[model samples]
Every structure is written in structure tokens, then in C-alpha cells.
Target: MKVLAARRRDAEDIRFLIDHLGLTNAEQVLALCGKVFPEEEMPGRARLVLGDIFDDS
Candidate 1:
């Protein structure tokens, strides 16, 4: 679905921002998401992706 693809794109964008901006902390990345995506939907999407990507390994 289009929404799923959009979420994936958002996740990739968040990953790019974190990596390219050298944000090594999940909290920091989330804060950036707060700025980049002030709307409720995208921030939530970013948070979900970030949670998975940054989870303890």
C-alpha cells in the first residue's frame, strides 16, 4: 500500500538524518524528528522505525 511505502520512506529519511547528521543517540534522533515532523503522524512513524532500528542488540 502507499501508506506503507511512505512509512518506509520516512524511516529511511530518519535513518539518513541520524547517520548523516552524526546523531548517535536515539533520544537525539527523536528530537530531530520532532523538528522535522511536527505533525502527529510522521513523528509517530519515525518513532516506530527508530525504535526498531535503534533497539538493543
Candidate 2:
């Protein structure tokens, strides 16, 4: 969880849109996650709550 937060912060610090892509909608966020972390192949339709992104929804 900490690692994820740290990497996200680093991406934001560098102003990398592709890395820290939490726009204002769930749909876009899901799509961005798919492109950013394709190897994980995260389910694009899963609900995204606050806190850990890997937490079971």
C-alpha cells in the first residue's frame, strides 16, 4: 500500500499524466489503470474505493 502511494506521489511530482491518472470519473480511471499497469491486467469494471487500490472490492 505504501509503495503504491509512493510511486503515485512520484508520478504526480514529475507531472506524468500517464502515471498518476485519477481524473474525475471512474470510467476514465479504470481505463488509465489498464493502460498504466497492463501486466497486472486489473479488472476494468471493478469499483475503486479510497485507500489501497489492490483491496478487494
Candidate 3:
């Protein structure tokens, strides 16, 4: 899966979650959006969109 973070900080947070939390893939990391920002509101929510590099299918 692909993640679309608004800012560099958010990207860093996502990476941390993935590494520290032992998330298997991008999808899992995206699921922790709320956990990352529980109290404060997140201006721009990150998107976990997938992309295709080549048309192999």
C-alpha cells in the first residue's frame, strides 16, 4: 500500500509507527492514524493509496 502524508513530520510519525509497532505493511500503518493523533485534531489526514509501477496484471 501507499501512504500520502501531508507533511514530513507526519511521514516520520508513520514510519515510527511502522517500525516500532512492527506493522507489516503500509495498510497497517495507515490504520494508526487515530492513534497517532488522539487528542489533537489532524489538519490533513494521510492517505494510504496504492500505485502500480508496471502493468504486469
What are the RMSD figures for all models against the true structure? 4.9, 8.0, 6.9
Q: What is the lDDT of residue 9 in candidate 2?
A: 42
Clash number for each model: 0, 0, 0
User: Compared with the true structure, what per-residue lDDT tens digits does model 2 show for residues 1-57?
Assistant: 222243544433323332465454445655666676776644322343322333322
How well does candidate 1 score on lDDT at residue 19? Answer: 75
Ranking by lDDT: 1, 3, 2
lDDT of each: 0.58, 0.41, 0.44
* Ranking of all predicted structures according to TM-score, beginning with the best and ending with the worst: 1, 3, 2
lDDT of 1 by residue, 1-55 (tens): 2222337656556566567788777778656655766663443555566676667
Among all windows of 10 consecutive residues in model 3, the one with the lowest summed lDDT is: 48-57
Write model 3 residue lDDT over 1-57, tens digit each, in one string: 113444544555445545676766544544565566566443434442211111111
Model 1 RMSD in Å is: 4.9
Clashing pairs in 1: none
Comparing 1 and 2 on TM-score, the stronger one: 1
Worst 10 residues of 2 by lDDT: 48-57
